[model samples]
Target: MNDELSLPATELVRRTLAHAKRLLPAALFHHSVRTYLYGRLLGEQRGLRPGRDYDDELLFLGCVLHDCGLSAEGDGDQRFELDGADLAVRFLEGEGVASDRAQVVWDAIALHMDREIAERKRPEIALVALGAGFDLGGGPERLPPGYTDRVHRVLPRLHAAAVLHDSIVRQALENPRKAPPFTMQGELVRQATGGSWPTWEHLARSAGWNDYEGYRP
Candidate 1:
């Protein structure tokens, strides 16, 4: 096993996992661990050295806690990404993490769902996005032989995406403000509301559909 995979988790990391286990569903808890494993795997492939190019503990915190916002306790009035980021920042600060390092974790959680942007942010940001995408079926890449089996053996995939989607839609239904424009939550709200809300795509395509260039009505 690689050092990142085999090394023991720190107190903060263990605490975060324990807290997630209590607050999040079983599938999500496992998914969180899988996310961290995937991130660590990608980091190793890229030759990133722990405590040098990156902090393993910090990366673990970012990946494992990335989806905390989806839980009822972590769900705030903002987008789940932002809420999760806030939760991570608060927890890290409470654990005496430095401001700069805590910010790195915050950025990783906040931008994991945003494609291209997250990849361009930094190594930690890119790793979290890469890990999450790989887990969620983003594309086919050849991992180390037996990597998938080993990881899945420890952390089973429990159809996490579908369950998470349902929870997000439910949260958005309860509070329209939670679904901002052009966001994942916004799309979910639109879907849940029978397409009543016009998405940015719909609006853009229909902007001048029935209007003359100089006409104002």
Candidate 2:
């Protein structure tokens, strides 16, 4: 990793995933981590570079910490974003980032899932929110009327997002333990899926186990 860009984002994401591993269902952990990474990759693709006004280190840290609240409970409430944002505000403030920049991170978290908020915020935060929305597959239906036209102007970014999403899904399948069993094999199929059995088969296939036929779910 380049020292100038600093690998803080990756490191922070790794640490956050590790921490979630100990507490969350494998599927949920994988989903959340992938979602965060998707946001980061999408942001980069969009040319929405993090400005010097905020430390890249802090931005990465904020991105990694952005979804921690989801681990606290299992619900689709947008409040999860707010909880994560509040946590980031405190964490970044302690890390010596200015209040204004910290607020940028907080606002990003708060509005990540809400396009209406994106329309009303600073460009920096709006960029982050755009990435988050894209990660959730928020098509033009979720955006305001003219937003899609504006976003279409950035073709490369959209292409990058599609590629990144595919990569993340492949990685998740390769490591079944990282994803919820149900996600890998729907709830109806979990019983037929076989706990560690499916995981082993997945690992084997990933490890080139073409002839190793075993129970598959």
Candidate 3:
């Protein structure tokens, strides 16, 4: 734990964990923690260093709080991503985080769902998206040797996909405004409610990477 993850042990970290654990569901809570772990791996793989390139604590905060909108406390009228971003920003501000840093985390949460822009941003922002996506989509083989088992051994994924999907779908069902077309929640609701919508994957392939089907990093 000390060498592999080296998770920050600040008071802020403690408060952040407590806040998230109280609000987020079991699956999401686990997924949030794993997001930090995966984000760390992604950062290392991309030659980014903690403290110098980005604050590890901020990265941890962003990853853990990224899905806050799914929680009842963070619920708001905007897209879950934006609502979650606002929730996190408020929390960070209350905890005395610098304004600029809070904005970065806001961007991290706001863009976590974006497959297009997040990867091109700074490490703190990019890692949250890349790591979250990697956790939810990519297989263990995509990571370095033994990394997946190590991460899972610490925090097992508890039906994350179904739990997360159901949570988002349920919210969108209750509040149609929460699911605007083209957003992740909206598309998910479309698929869940049996409505017609072009999937992101279909669009991505049409946009060109179709020839790189089996390509691996």
Candidate 4:
């Protein structure tokens, strides 16, 4: 317990998870915990010290609540990311957390889906995205030895990626406005509904794709 990064059992964390579990599908709740575990591993690999380069509490809050926008309470006119960020921020504020710390969590959750921007931000923000990206893309071979096993043992794989992807597609299908053109959500909807082939997936697997004409790295 001393060496490992354990999820705090504070009342706040407990209540937050309770609320998330109530709204999010079982697959999503497991996804959130896995995201936090990945973030913890990333923090260690980067030599981040507790209470300095990163705050474990904020990291947990950001990673666990990152996908909360998909929850019913998180739905709004804006994208799920923004809606979730706003919800997390308000929740933190209600708990009397300082505005600055609350803002870091907001940034992490809101930018988790945007790797390019999130990477250039604070460690808290970058780790959130890195964690989610790693988990969604499947466990990387280079992750710390036994780290993946440790996380998986505590939070077993629930095939959340497929569940989440379907949820996003369903949301977009229900409200075309939910998925704007060219965005990830829009692309998912397009592919799911057979509007177009999955060229994006093809390009992702292409060899030396950056060298292709009109391709930007």
Best by lDDT: 3
lDDT score of residue 69 within candidate 2: 49
Clashing pairs in 2: 27-179, 27-180
TM-score per model over all chains = 0.85, 0.44, 0.86, 0.82
Residues 1-217, candidate 2: write the lDDT tens digits.
2332233445544554465456444444434443343444455654545554334444454444555544443123334556567766665576566898788778776676566766477555655565555545654423345543433332213343444334334333444333344342233234433444356557667887584766565
Error of 4 at 159 (Å): 1.1
Please, what are the lDDT tens digits per residue for candidate 3 over residues 60-96?
A: 9999999999999988898888999999999999999
Q: lDDT at 213 for candidate 4?
A: 62
Q: Which stretches of candidate 1 lie over 4 Å from their true place?
A: 1-4, 199-217
Least accurate 10 contiguous residues by lDDT in model 1: 1-10
TM-score of 4: 0.82
In candidate 2, stretches whose alpha carbon ends up further than 4 angstroms from where it belongs are 1-29, 50-55, 73-78, 138-217
Clash pairs for candidate 3? none
Give the candidates in order of lDDT, highest first. 3, 4, 1, 2
Error of 2 at 12 (Å): 6.6
**lDDT value for model 1:** 0.80
Residues 65-113, model 4: lDDT tens digits: 8888888888876677888899988888998889999999999998998
lDDT of 1 by residue, 67-104 (tens): 88988878898888789899888887998889999999
The best candidate by TM-score is: 3
